[model samples]
Target: MAGPNIKHAAYHGPSIMKEIFFGISLSLMAGYLWKRHHWNIQRRTREFYGLLDRGEISVVVEDD
Candidate 1:
């Protein structure tokens, strides 16, 4: 009983730690990508608005 419990604990300890590490790594990567995506969107929006402000582009509104 003692031997089996010790073996199980040893096996599960590293497994649990590996899972936690991967989870943290994935979360950090996802957060970084999300932040970059947000920045890119904001940059594009600013550029578009700047173009409109400069009369480089125009929008035509139509009546529904």
Candidate 2:
């Protein structure tokens, strides 16, 4: 019990718990957005394939 006086060391800024919560929330939101974007890409790809299969769109070859 022979430590120095440390009574005035309280941090008066954002709380650690709050910061952690916000960081976790932001990360989860980012992941959710990424998943949605991936799903969108997949859906578009499927649609494009369907169109091609049904002859709704065609591919043209060019000479080299």
Candidate 3:
């Protein structure tokens, strides 16, 4: 019984590695998307106002 149990013991190394890789990939993707969206909004706002630089750190969007 001891020998059989040892033989069937679970190894979680591969699953843990896979989860770490997946988490990193997802975090990087989310960060990239967030940055891209922010840049796009800044670009559009600059074009609309003919601004030369992104001087302000934040912009208020009012409902119309």
**Best candidate (score: TM-score):** 2
The sequence of per-residue lDDT tens digits that candidate 2 reaches over residues 2-46 is 889777877799989999999999999999999999999999999
**What lDDT would each prediction earn against the true structure?**
0.88, 0.94, 0.79
* Count of clashing residue pairs in every prediction: 0, 0, 0
Q: Residue-wise lDDT of candidate 1 within 6-63, one digit each (tens)?
A: 4333443457788899999999999999999999999999999999999888897758
RMSD of every candidate to native, in Å, equals 6.4, 7.4, 9.2
Residue-level lDDT for 52 in candidate 1: 99
Output the TM-score of candidate 3: 0.55
Query: Could you tell me which 10 consecutive residues in candidate 3 have the lowest summed lDDT?
Result: 50-59
Question: In angstroms, how far off is 37's CA in candidate 2?
Answer: 1.2
Candidate 2: Cα lDDT at 27 = 100
Task: Write the residue-wise lDDT of candidate 3 on 1-64 in tens digits.
Answer: 3454455677656687888999999999999999999999999977866643554443566689
Which residue runs of candidate 1 sit more than 4 Å off their true CA positions?
A: 1-14, 61-64
lDDT of 3 at 3: 50
Task: Report the CA-based lDDT of candidate 3 relative to the real structure.
Answer: 0.79
